[model samples]
Target: MGVIGLLMRPSELMALVKLKKQIGVWKRRSAAQEKDADWEFCFDMLNKVSRSFAIVIEQLGDELRNAICVFYLVLRGLDTVEDDMAIDNATKARLLLSFHDMIEEEGWDLHYGYKDEKVLLEEFDRVVRAYRSLKPQYRATIKDITRRMAEGMQKFTEMEVTKIADYDLYCHYVAGLVGIGLSQLFSGSGLEDQGIAQDEALSNHMGLFLQKTNIIRDFLEDHEDYNEETDTRRVFWPKQIWGKYTDKLENFTFGKNQEQAVACLNHMVTDALRHLPYSIEYLSNISDEQNFLFCAIPQVMAAHTLALCYANPDVFKGKIRKNLGECRNTHPVKIRKGLSAKLMLETTDMQATLSILEDAIDSLADKISPTDPSARETIEKVQLCRDLIVQGRRSSSPSSKVASTWRQETSKATSYVAEQCTVPLLVLLFGITAAVDVPQALGSAWWQSEAVPAKLGPVHVWLTSLALAFYSLTLLLLTRGAALSWCKALSAAQVAMTAAEVVFSPVVGLSVVVQALPKLLLAAMLPSCAKQRHSRQLFAKQQAAMGNRRVLRPRPIKADKSY
Candidate 1:
């Protein structure tokens, strides 16, 4: 129905043609992978649940293709139970808590209420059959994530999303876990670098970004989703946010509070935008083309969805906004068929994707109101996205063939040098902060060597104490796997203090200046810590995910893997 309305526009019509061709290719690719009745049913269920995900899932290698298909279905089945209002809270909670085990039980089935989901759940044994056929590592990854997610869902089922932190944790459980599970599957398949799986924090952002967009865009639908018998509405919009806009969540849907509502909506959109840079970094690290597209297409689509939803009134309207004239509904909040198709075509082209992302960032920035409480935050996040886009544009440029070749070669060698130096450099910073056998800068030099005992001045001692305090706080919050902003601020302050010591310490000689240079370069290098969201959460988050247990030390892969 939406596609029929979109056909009037020439560009959309062209996009539709291209989209059809792509589907044809995917279908041809899928035919070879389909085995028997059980697999066919699973694939059929995949299509019904998500055409976008199923198409990409089918294009994967034979072994991986089955594992991912089963993984997605298991997660989707869990989600269906969570979303189905027909189930009583007790029943839902019980089901969610045990969903991980249910996948292995061939007799497990339930009537989840949604038409498509009813079929998926009722015939879930087929999915279980397919899942058992997967590699043991793949099955382990799927089971571990499903267990964690189900526990999370059951927990959240009993609470309201009252705070932004609550909202993030909820999103982490439902969506972020999907990202982590996929990464585990990817690495377990040996199709991607182990670092990709090890970087659970990065994976979490990718899912959060997409999940938050869905939460924001479906505002009207989720808002209106009331169950009279249970006397509950499945509202995921955090009260900490919506409470400031209007006294009631449904007030956003009314005309009287439209002004305040749009501000609230823009605030949510901006919060989602904060995750974009991390998503880009995760996608940039994908080495396989199919894997890249599998992640990239949906990510690009989410960015466009945010572009369409930014301060748009239709989000509060109770319908899918359709594209009719110039594929016009893109602005009205529904990501249209043609535009998604066009975005898929552009996913492989970094510059094209950046242009789309830049447009989305512009859409978000242009709507920031000075009067809104979150206006400054929205502006800052928007600018961050733009900055990253600018960097992407520069990197994707191909005009200088000679320079590009030289850069690739130099980057290879420089990358190796960085690999060897990185650990020792980190150790030096830790050693200095720890007051381990190391020289303290006297604010005028690395140390006054003339002093026989080298007892430090109060200023030097204080600076060391301050840096140590910052390190301790940063590490502590990192251990808790919370307070991302705190992590960034502390890390940034630590870097700045190091820089101050390097610059303020008098360059007593060329030897002194030379000694300070690496510290200065290390300071410069650590900006990525500030630039990337959840930088400290990489190990800490994985630690927390593994039941607050310690993480295994990662074996280093090639430092300069391709985007």
Candidate 2:
């Protein structure tokens, strides 16, 4: 079965079908008459090395597609060298620094690496030949990036990365350069704005975001077994971040430290997400639809992967890749729509933009039944986006607008106080019921004369006391944010107290039922309260995990008169 075959959802299946159809069209159009054996070999290598990328690369127009295929293979060869630990440090460093120069050397290749990548290294002459066949500008761009990346890899291979900056530098060398190179290719192909190609900061962020995600996701695999001979692990997580959490990077994966591990993972995800706005900006600037998709597929996949990694303990246990079906099924286009809505809101009237967003969300719900879990999540995220916009607008206004904000805050405070007091109110009611029943149970003439059972006095007192104790305990648990199981148990005890009252005295039983109703309702709501508490705890943990790192809260858009 293909990757998409793993837990295939209907929507995802449809998306995969559409993607395949698009790929088919590109393949048909790019089909060469009397195909060159060298070009064919390059594509074959792409499929073998990275099938996922092959799908996207194949969708490119003929010229750009071929260029990218060769570019990918060249980088794959370079990466193979960096990954192969068996190569002596001296040889690896030398080859890396000179690898770019060898592109024009004819018949240049490396034979030593992991089994899967070794073939690419050995057949790299074909990649270099294809590179040479590209236009001079494309060739120069590829060579420039390759040379710089090789040097960076050489430096890191020989030294330890003890700081976050060093880690970013290493990522820049390995992946950031690829982003720069691709931008140059896009610009050289006359498909994207030339200015975008020169925006190194944006390009660097694009690469760093992707590289950090890969490093974070592959933490377990990368640190599994250090080179036994060298007693060193192949890790990209900056010591600056992980060192604060644990003495050994591997400890984060331990069962006892899973919480810390998840926090650390969330922190890394947050760092990666910082680049999202720039990435969105990059996408917005792209004019070529196919090129945009080409760039978009990976960015969307990165976001989906980060979501999977968030608070996921299994990431430390082993590999946790999204199934092909799941990856294919993700609605990245919806995310793009969300970004557009945000941009529009920032540049248009707030109320008008929000109305448009609401309509879009409703339309989305109509198409994908709100009953669907995915649809619900999407709707929730979009609504959150809308709320964020409203909050931004409110926060940005002058002092005259402060009155409305104060009113909203006051109302929220009132609701919060009311919610918090429910348990205490239940406790008070339980105490009152117990007190009231004592007088009745003591055979007070007025109470006993009304059809009271002759033998019910002690039983009434016992039931009331038991209920009082149960309600007090339930209140304690609710205040402590105890599990739902405990709340249910307390509820069961209340039910028993009601049953005893009913059997002994109908009037008292009716009164007990009325008094116990609120407690029962509160018990029922505890589960939801527990859920909210859990969410708050998770958020707190995430913040703690981030430590001194500034969390990226979305900023409000300034209203534009342009609606």
Candidate 3:
């Protein structure tokens, strides 16, 4: 509990408090009374094996909860056997393939395994007894999935995976199968649509998303066996990806190849994001509120884990995890919004990367100003690293080179005058367009005629002025590389300006479009600029590598905010 308290973020602490209250209410419910001795023992094993999952599982209704509980224990036992490197390859393979068959036999248990999971392994017979007590449909679904999963694990045990496709296949066996099994149970309990269970692709993505994230997060531990002397290392990273970055997977952990390691990590995170849509769809299809929550909690954690692991060098040095407070505080809504924003930015590619770096700097600066001296130093160092990266990117750009050439050709005061005049020149152009439109409308026969439209009276002048003001503000923000909120507001204002034009007169609309096109074009160029900046940064780093120079690694920052 003390270790948990230390690891938990403040938000996770609050979440734990709320969870305890909920569990108390659950204890008073009929669901708690229905638990038998075997079920209680099985649940205790679940807690020991996975405390986080146990919290979500406890919130479920009795029949479904017990079914999932048994399902988890059965898989846990099988995983224990697969993970025990002490077991010979042939023997382990045989046991995995036949593992499902053992569940039907009364009092069947395997105690030889990892010390932490030994309790569940030794007492697995009780889990089998509990499984037998489940309704026929639940038993059938769990048994089928267990058999398929065991078969898949057996296949992988016989050989090492060398390709990305094979890695995905291996993940499918261990995790995707669990997703399918859960969907079956959800359908069997009449809590979700039966169609959901049948959608193998969706179920597979849901499982693969979490599985890939875990694999990436565990790179430091999984790269080598606990005993380096006589044990073969367990290499789960697909050769296809890592091979591109390094000659050997182990090299990624070395300081010299830190950049490559981060690249590999980012590549993996991007791959995991591809499955997000399917995962969201699966969660959305679950109609029950409790069921939806049970499914969502893990997805949110996975999303946050990806975000933390993205640029952080800790993935290579050691295991990285979200604090319990952070994990508990993350909600499905927040994850969904983040995913949406991320996807939008991703579509713009390089521009989005630059935008993200810019945002990171501002965020770090805010934290640096209020922190203790030691913390401030760390924040400042990270900010400096980011600034260097940004500068490197700018130096590599053709536009930057052109600007440098122009500055070299002109005197400092002349260059300054040219820079100062550009904004005023554009504003004057827009102001003239506005001034011309008002007079043209006033002088037109449509304006002087008695039958002038009410919607197109003197109010048109006010709308035109308001639109001009918004357009000018948008242009100013775009020039300054504004925040995302300003960009969103600019987009909304553009819509309003267009709408106001339609309400005013055709001439007014035409004048607005004429003035707005350049601003719109400039707004569109921001992402391209960002993309170019990132490209230049990567190119500069590559050139340094070619010159046999060691590139400086970005220092890790201790920021309070989760990804």
Candidate 4:
């Protein structure tokens, strides 16, 4: 789910049109035949979103649309099974297993004339037929994803209690895996190289981000459903974490536990943010038509939604949302801007954009602030860190070379600092041994003196020395890292600072440094003994110099290459 994905072919659209047309016809007929206004409304509501997807697909050439439509229907069928209460667990299990069997048995029947036969099995069959008709290359993608979905579904069991991990698996099965499939479609659509590794990362992460969003959004609904007197229950939130925070899971419903709910929402949002970069990268990889609606729309929607969620605290109010109008107006403009700015992805402006978007999402759950107090401190810190990183890159003799090297060296330095910090203190205890002293009679021959026992002396010294050395290294490493981190933080703060010229001018930088004097004084007042342990080592100077010089060097320039 972490990979970038390819595009679907142009020809695939034909199949999608056919399947959608059938679903449309089936909907009309069923609405008339069953006379169930509520049922029709439900499908219509779902289709409102699905139709947007269809429009995007239709715009793609037929070949891609056809394949996507089939996959879409198959997914819809699974969703129907999961949602439909009329069917027994036995039937649901059978249907889930049948999906896997259908992949191998091209003409296999998944629904087998069950309740809601027309909506589930009929639509599923149409997609299957369309899939079989696709060229072998497209067929292969469908088959692979279908198999993954089936594998994920078949693993579900009625006899066991559901775990958080299982819910994650379920998300992977239904949505994250689809993200992977869609990525492949995007890659294969003949837009660009659509490198497998990058696409795979995008595919997986996008799906995960979306799935996590759904979980966060659905917390209220899930909580309500879980409490119903039914055989099934929702346990999407991990019991360990939820139990630690609150006694009753029901408290998580929107109104009563808004703050707690938001905290849980934050956890999922944080998890999604971890994957946001990949989602961006994945969208960036897509070329032409597929990029617009498929890549751009969802990416922007999710981002805006995240921003809204962050800015507002009412997400627990049944169904908190940033309506479509907001998405419609904001996304196109942002995407237009994004496409142009994509080349300088690692630049400050780019980072600022991401930070802004993240803040926007977070702002939904909290109050929007021009100078939000909660994140102001963190923002300032990160700004300084990045600025130092940028400054270290710009300070070389030629300046241009420094500028060029800034990207490469700073990254290496930052990574080195982080990497060195992560090494365990135990690693420095490699060559330890132990011995002890004992008293002996003076008359005894020197050689026959009572042997000193081989106690844990050497070992203790080695361990203690190592611990001290590691502690020392950690302090030094932290100082340099903190300095670099501070540098970036200052750089970030400069943007948010009230007066840019004033902040960057000699006076403000000096003032900021002065304000930081307490921390600086504390750091300096700590004993110089921290760096003394390795003083006699052969390469101690070299190591210290190397570590020091890295901070003074340039950063890695991630060249913007064609997707």
Please give the CA lDDT of all the candidate structures: 0.71, 0.63, 0.62, 0.46
Summarize candidate 1's per-residue lDDT along 1-563 as a digit string, tens digits.
56544643456678878878987887778787648898899988999988889977877777588888999999999988888776888889889988888887786788774667779999898999988888899999999999999999998888989998899899999999899999988888788999999988889888999999999987776756666687888789998888878889777773447888888888898889878988877876787777877888888889889977876777876543322200112233567777777777766645556666775675455445456677667666766677776565455546633444464467556645643454456566666556531354443344445532355556556667776665555445544544343533454465567656554443346655665566555543332332232333443443343353332332222212111
Better of 2 and 4 by lDDT: 2
Candidate 4 minimal-lDDT segment of 10 residues: 1-10
Worst 10 residues of 2 by lDDT: 324-333
TM per candidate comes to 0.68, 0.60, 0.57, 0.49
* lDDT, residue 357, candidate 3: 36
Candidate 1 colliding pairs = none
| Tens digit per residue, CA lDDT, model 3, 185-223 | 999999888888887778888898899888877776666
Sequence-dependent TM-score of model 3: 0.57
- TM-score leaderboard ranking: 1, 2, 3, 4
lDDT of 3 at 389: 41
Model 2 stretches with alpha carbons more than 4 Å out: 1-8, 32-34, 254-256, 319-563
Instruction: Give a tens-digit lDDT track for model 4, residues 38-73.
Output: 333334433543664554444445446556766676
lDDT of 2 by residue, 1-563 (tens): 33433222233455555556665776776665235888888887788889768877887887698888878888888888888766778888888988889988787677876555777788778777788888998889888988989988988987777787787788788888888899999999998889878877677777877788788777776665456667777788877777756788768753449767765665665556555445544655567867866776676556545555655666777432333111111211122222322322222222333333333333222222222223333434434544554554454446524644574567556546545766667767766666666556554434445455544466677776776676677667766655443544554455556556666653554565675576556644554454445435544554454455433356633321110
